[model samples]
Target: MHFDLADLRLFVHIAESPSLTQGARRAHLSAAAASARIKALESQLDSRLLYRDNRGVELTPSGQRLLQHARLILRQVERLKDDFSEQGGDQAGHIRIFANTTAVTEFLPEVLAGFLAARPAVTVDLQERLNRDIVRAILDGSADLGIVAGPVRAEGLEILHFSTDHLVLAVPPGHALERLGRPPTLADTLGYFHVGLHEGSTLQSFLREQVERLGGTLNLRIQVASFEAACRMIEAGVGIGVLPETAARRHQRSMGLSILQLDEPWVVRERSVLVREREALPGCARTLVELLRQVGDGVVAP
Candidate 1:
């Protein structure tokens, strides 16, 4: 029995969207056509692949298992084709990457520059989003890779540690917190007005948990979406904010802010690079991953 690549592609899309109508839109096919294809694939394999419910579709156990092999086969086929076509001279392709702002500004530029210098014909499409969105992008296959400030665990994604950052407390110059000679505990931090990223974001999630564990409450005065915004708010004396050390350091001089170490041990953040699956990475995606790994190892050329 033979399975068509189109069928596998459709299946993956279905798994990602879970709604037949939405999946068809993403695949640029009509609902009837997408349903017919799924039906045909299921009939050909003599197995039910999906279950449609009132809300959306879900992959059966068999379908879930097949997805792994499907991705591996497709990636291998593409890689084989690329290998026979060229030997990596000015490789022509595009890679989709999603990253958080810190990585977008701090880490990605050097790796991207090196990749471009080596493969000028290729193009990099980068989107700066929050860590949660970055995780979803990788799982949906919309992004070939994701760089995020938190660990991502999903059905089909593999995460590799890329870097670690400290989450430092930032206060405007001469703020009361800045003058505190001793590191503030949870109780002390909560007394100060807080500015932080909005809910449903990685930093917010992490901070909320830490605050809860510390048995303290945050004033939570302002909720901004970006780290830069948080820093600016702190500089304006809106409130104290927590931000990545790299970002806070970069802007502290200009913003006239002071970075204070939190008294708790949970203030450090680890960042990672995520791929949908290792064996399914396209040639371009593999090269990009290599660049990230090399950069993480501090072996990249300046």
Candidate 2:
């Protein structure tokens, strides 16, 4: 039998609350209107739906069965409306994104600006977290896309390499490492006290792996959770650190710190763009990914 979604909505609301008065309150209808809708639905189905008693309302056997179907039908109807709205081809829906600290602060500004300029109707929401957290957002469908560092592994997700950012050595102006004319090897650099961020960061992981590959380990003097804290310690001559070039440039002059390009063997970290499905990406999300590719084209050589 065919029934209107409005009828099903009223039924579910009544079934959930089991009290016509409360259901009407929840659905923003008067008692008479709610009872009328429920009676109409019961007539259309040719069955007794509810039994009235001192406990307010109780469902008949048929009513209990129809309640489940009503909930499913209402959910599908809502999904259909959302799908059609998003397919309106107006580029005027919400898009959520996840990104790491470096990308959020240093990389996405220009790309996001260009996107907002072109698609004025679209609204962008962004959050900053570590690479793993960003990946989790995409997998759980909480974010439409994610920008992160290397080593993302998930089924049905396509990872695209967009840029490669080197980890530069930053030292206080008067620090021993700053007195050297040329950059030192990972081994030689570790001979001095080292300041670094805590271990969970992708950048920190990358540095540790590279150092281990060269048969050495960092003598970390202090490990803080934030890059700003690490930079502060480095500026105070507590030790040297390997930080992103983008971040280093932002605070180097003001913080009285100097950044030196490490030797060729120590170049670390490559930034990547990730999407759940490249071919089926939403229109606005696809556009943003393309813009990032264009901007970082020369930054990462293939």
Candidate 3:
């Protein structure tokens, strides 16, 4: 019924690695010590927490729930320590952020570079995630902040306008799609082969969802990791691609790519920043949020 931070930390490592030996090594304990700890945890909780197999270990449902709580607890403890350290003039902190693909690849890099440059003792852990997932992570205390596009469903989290962007079709100049004499809709372009973003990209997932809603599939000829790569492929006439207008415009002239506006309502995207509570955030995290707002407002060029 009672366990310490060490127990929670050890459990998290084991669940993440799914290897007793590796988890033990990470916790600076031997395999036997780690195994004993796990057994003690299971007995204390009165639940089976893992499933063992030749491959590795898998968390049981109970273990999955525990993992979530453990992460949240550890994060809160870190935040407390960071607050105390900063107040003591050490100014050391770590901020975790979850953002969608556009924010990750297009928006945050320049802003983060400036933020990190001024605060050498501050570190950021930025990750790309789906919009909804980003919102959930913020609510769960797993992420200090989030940048997401489209509508946000987070009820209690603070949402600030981040930026506005639109998805556009990028094709080779004089391509068949460009010759349509009008802006082509996503449905119209589905028939053509397309260069797409990587499978895990939020933008790529959004495109697929839209395609499915229209009862069609994206005819992707190849998948690349970035908007630039997609534009390069489109310029080579490999296939057409959907890209954020901001990114597409940057490469349009150099790549000889034609940008076609999509005739769908969802094409227009609004990005927002989500925070649990502004006043409750660590000092460094609050500063970063302010910087993000400035960039979003065009006070600072990104």
Candidate 4:
């Protein structure tokens, strides 16, 4: 029996999305079209693939097993396209990249802009996630590459050094932090409302771990997906936030956010890039990865 790649891709989208409606939108299909596709897929497999509920659809046992093979098959198809593209005809295929918040906001903007300029035919699907989640994505063939900060155990992946970044506390003007008359430690500021990065972000997770060690915890008033949003939260006096030094200072003047010094040694961290395997990466992915490593000054590489 032959399987349709369109159905498999749509199934993957539905599996990852919060709802069938949203998944259909992502796949650019009308709800009726998506339902028909899923029904055909189920009929072809002769098993139920998803369980629809009020909250959303969940994978049935058959779907759970099929998801694994679907991801692998789709990945192979993408590699084939990239292989052909690299043979010199017009380039094609997409690259899915997962990166941490700091790299997403601070580093990748310029890096990706340059890569896209040179290879206009290639598409990059980028997502922000914590290092741990990025690890899972790369291992499962769901993501082509990942850029994350802090230590990660990537057993089956090829790793390379990316960059280093420092985390600094951002507070609003006239906040109590200003009256402290000196640099405050992370623990010193844990008592107040704070803004934070996404729940799975490395910096945010690391900050939470640090606070727990100090017999305190973060009292986040809000959680934002980007550093700019966190800066906005601080600017409104909604809460204090920890941010990358470069990002904090970049908007310090314009956003009226203050950077508070942290004396903690672990506040500085290094980033690394993870891929399934260097040799196995497709042509477009290889090109983008090399550009990422070589763009800055030939320093970031294993």
Candidate 5:
């Protein structure tokens, strides 16, 4: 049977989108054209791929099965592109690295710098995402590698222990919580306004979940995108903030922000690097993973 990549790509897009119209737009096809293509594909396959109605299309069992393989095939196609881009044996390829705020902020820069210096022909595209989102991107074939700030399901991925990240609450020096010498439980501070990361951030999600577990609700005063922003908001006396230890120390001595140890075991976050399986990574991406794995490359001790 002849399989068309274009049809498969459109099918994947349609399956992901809320409506066939939206998916066709994303694929740069007119609704009529896209509909025609899908009809032809269904005829060729002798199966219904979608249940179409006014609202949207739902994937049939056959469409669902095809989506799984389509994603894998497209991922392999991207791999082929990266693997073939070369210049005189000096690896020339693009690697996409998706990481959570902690790994992106504290760990990856220096490591990536050294790797890029050695492999000058390789290009790195780094993006910051929440930890679980990073895992999803990797599993869905959208990202070549991922660095997440905690353990996640590793069903089909190769894992690398990257670093240890400890979180502490940052408060303005004279804040009410600062008067107490003992570490504060999350419940103790739920009454105060908080400087939180972005709403959908992994750290923010964890904090919110913990607050819920403690039978309290988060009262966020402001939401910023990074630890630096949160620290700055804290320094401005806006509200208390949770930050990585690396950031807290760097800012504490200068910003005069007081670091309060979190009285919870989960505050110490473990970071890990994940890939589609070590061998599946292209040469350029694999090299970077090796650099992360190298013991002496400042891999923080547990």
Candidate 6:
């Protein structure tokens, strides 16, 4: 029973993707070729790997174990390549980061721009994901680093303080909530129609969870894709919105929106950086982490 690195790589892509065809595309293989390879791999292991249905494929128990090992092995292989490249005076590599919406939209761009400018040989694959998914990706070796908001419960991961942000309500000037002259709890704003983030946004999902916990539902007047759009809608008096304080401040004057603090514990949020093992990270990845730490320290304003 033997499988090559290519087979392992393909399997990893397939397991991570939504469909076999998509996985094949990621691996730069035709669908038929990828299917044949998977079959051969299953035969070599003497176990079924994936359960196929109309929607897509789900990994079998055996496939799940293989995926775990495969990701670890691939990460090790990439590290090995990085080490050799560094020895040859070419410190070039790719780093994958999974971050939440706030980090993605409000924090990372400036930092990433400078980092990329300095390290011409390094490439970054940054993806927006939910905090929980970010933690899972780091633990599973699928992501080199993660920036997550709120509490983290991952036992073995290294957590670094990144930044602090708050969820604030964005209201039009002279809105009823604004006239109240006090920090309003989420419950207090439940009756007002709201401008909300897109349905797929992690922040939106988080807000929905909070609303459900409070035994209320959002009376959404409109749903937009970004903080800016939500601010625009709020400024137009379509509705109020819950947005990051960082974003609210940035657009407050221009958008003529009032930013109100929420009287809730969860409104104050801490963003943290996560890694499986910092010392074990690739050289380029480690450098990126340090740069992020500098930003957190206020040594460099991002």
Name the best candidate (by TM-score): 6
The lDDT of model 4 is: 0.83
Query: Per-residue lDDT of 202-261 in model 6, one digit per residue for the tens?
Result: 799899999999999889988988888888888899999999998999998687888888
Best-fitting candidate, measured by lDDT? 6
Ranking by TM-score: 6, 3, 5, 4, 1, 2
List the candidate 2 regions with Cα displacement exceeding 4 Å.
1-90, 117-121, 132-140, 151-156, 179-182, 209-229, 264-268, 298-302
Off by over 4 Å in 6: 1-3, 53-55, 86-90
Per-residue lDDT for 15 in model 3? 80
> Taking the tens digit of each residue's C-alpha lDDT, what string does model 1 give over 1-302?
99899878878778878598898888889989999999998898888999998999998988877776676566567667666656562286667788876677676887788788887667888877777777777775567788887555655678888568887889888878766789866567788899988776656776787788878787888998777788899989889987789889988867878898888776766778888876666677787787787777778753
What is the C-alpha RMSD, rounded to one decimal, of candidate 1?
4.1
Q: Would you list the rank order by lDDT, best first?
A: 6, 3, 4, 5, 1, 2
Candidate 3 lDDT tens digits, 1-302: 68789989998888868587888888999989988889989999999998877788899999988888887788768768876783432256788899988888987998889787878888898999988889888886778899988887899899988678899989898888777888899999988999999988899999999999999989999999888888999999999988999999998868889888988999988888899887767778888888888887788875
Q: Write the per-residue lDDT of candidate 2 for residues 83-177, one digit (tens) a residue.
A: 47644543555567888767776768767786787777778888776787778666645566888875667666788887788778888887666
* lDDT per model vs. reference: 0.78, 0.75, 0.86, 0.83, 0.81, 0.88
Q: 104-189, model 4: which lDDT tens digit per residue? A: 77878888786777777878889888788899999887898999777789998988875677788889988888788887898888
The candidate with the higher TM-score, 2 or 4, is: 4
Q: Which ten residues in a row have the lowest lDDT in candidate 3?
A: 83-92
CA displacement after TM-score superposition, residue 261 of candidate 4 (Å): 4.4
Taking the candidates one at a time, how many backbone clashes does each contain? 0, 0, 0, 0, 0, 0
Report the number of backbone clashes for model 6. 0
Q: Please give the range of 10 consecutive residues that has the lowest summed lDDT in model 1.
A: 81-90
Better of 4 and 5 by lDDT: 4
C-alpha displacement of 18 in model 1, angstroms? 6.0
Distance from true location, Cα of 261 in model 6, Å: 1.9
